[model samples]
Target: MQLGKAVRLERIMNRNNGRTIIVPLDHGVTVGPIYGLVDLRETVNQVAEGGANAMLMHKGIPRCSHRRHGRDIGLIIHLSASTSLSPHPNAKTLVGSVTDAIKLGADAVSVHINLGDETESRMLADLGAICSEANEWGMPVLAMMYARGPKIENEYDPDVVAHCARVGVELGADIVKVNYTGDPKSFVRVVEGCCVPVVIAGGPKLENELDLVRMVHDSVQAGGAGLSVGRNIFQHPNPVKIVAALHKVVHEDWDIDAAMELL
Candidate 1:
């Protein structure tokens, strides 16, 4: 890896603990301007102050996000997109390139790949090609792998989730973001199968803050590095407090009830 890329990766991965806490704010492309992300800058500020190690956003966001707030939070540029309004939402196309992400001053780059979809083969091909290119550029690639389609029985299926995680690493992702299998024992298989570091996605908004906290705690206990939560943190009444509580679970290893008290 190049000196700059190596330094960036090292900075994102906590040296004291090999895990990471990445707050993803690229939802605008998929779900439009949701409640929590109505003001992207404010949301970014909240997560940054709450001790999130890194924040992932699409190209436009980093360009306008508060530079001071970003000083502490490593920025990752997401390169793929599939909007809710689109007829085929599962088809994630590459909207940006790694070179463009570098020019945007991104510390890393990410792509979303939907497994079991009709377009699965094409997306996987794109992921593989991008991973190879990123390797040459010395840039780290985060793969957001999700199971969704007619063939997929359940997103939480242990076998299916494990295969999704493995595919990301096999395709060359430095870090894999996937959905947690409801149980810790089942989720462990997913983590164990992946060669790269694995993190769980927040999925959708939860009914309550405690539910979200418990999910994060469970994922961590199951051997996930951390979380790439979006709506759960940003949509909460107090994003800063929510992120702080999540930090306790992810970085401090606190239980759900204990972390909820901090909220």
Candidate 2:
């Protein structure tokens, strides 16, 4: 890698103790102002102060997020989306380009891919093309891989989830964001199979805080570099405390019980 690219990667790795704690505020494009993220800046500030290393958002949010926050959280630009109200919500379309992301001063750019969906082929082509472009720009790509098709009833199936993660790396993603397989042993397979660093998605918001901490702990134990959580942190009664707890799990390698105590 070139000096600039290597520096950027180092910055990302350094932020979360070689692991990552990225709080995604890109929800507005998909599900406008979902309960907790109504005020994006305030929520981002709280998490950033609580030790979050990075914040992922669509173009709009980053346009306003402060550059000199408590600890210079890295910014990731999400380039794909399809709102829930859209006619084909699952068919993600490109909304921003890698060049646009760089122009926005993004440290990295992310794309969402729904494997096995009707529009899978189109999205895959886009992903490959975007990866190529990102390579030339020396920009990192974070692929959010999820299985969603008629055949995929349970995304948690070990084999299916593993395949989804592998495909993301194969498509040239620098970092693959995937769902946790409920157990460290199974999730370890997914992480081992991917060529690039693996990170776990927060998925939907959970009702309990401990459940979220346990999931992060398990994923990290399974070799995941870190987490890309959204609703789980933002929707919590105390997002700052929640992030601090998660940081302990992802960065400090604390167990669920220990991490929960921080909350």
lDDT of 1 by residue, 1-263 (tens): 57866777766767566678888888898888878777777788888878888889888887567556344788889999999999999999999999988898778899999998999999999999999999888899999999999988898888988999999999899999999888788888998898778899888777888777887788889888888888787777887888788888888888888887898
Worst 10 residues of 2 by lDDT: 9-18
Model 2, backbone clash pairs (residues 3+ apart or across chains), number: 0
- Over 1-263, each residue of candidate 2 has an lDDT whose tens digit, in order, gives 66666666665665345688888888888888788777767887888877887888888776566645556778888999999998788899999999888888888889999998999999999999999999888888899999987778898888888898888889888888988899999998998888788888888878798788888888888888989998888888888898898887888888887886778
User: Cα miss at 57, model 1 (Å)?
Assistant: 1.1
lDDT of each: 0.85, 0.85
Find the 10 residues in a row with the least total lDDT in model 1.
62-71
Off-target runs (Cα >4 Å) in candidate 1 are 1-4, 69-71
Record all residue pairs in model 1 with backbone atoms less than 3 Å apart, i.e. clashing. Answer: none
Inter-residue clash pairs, candidate 2: none
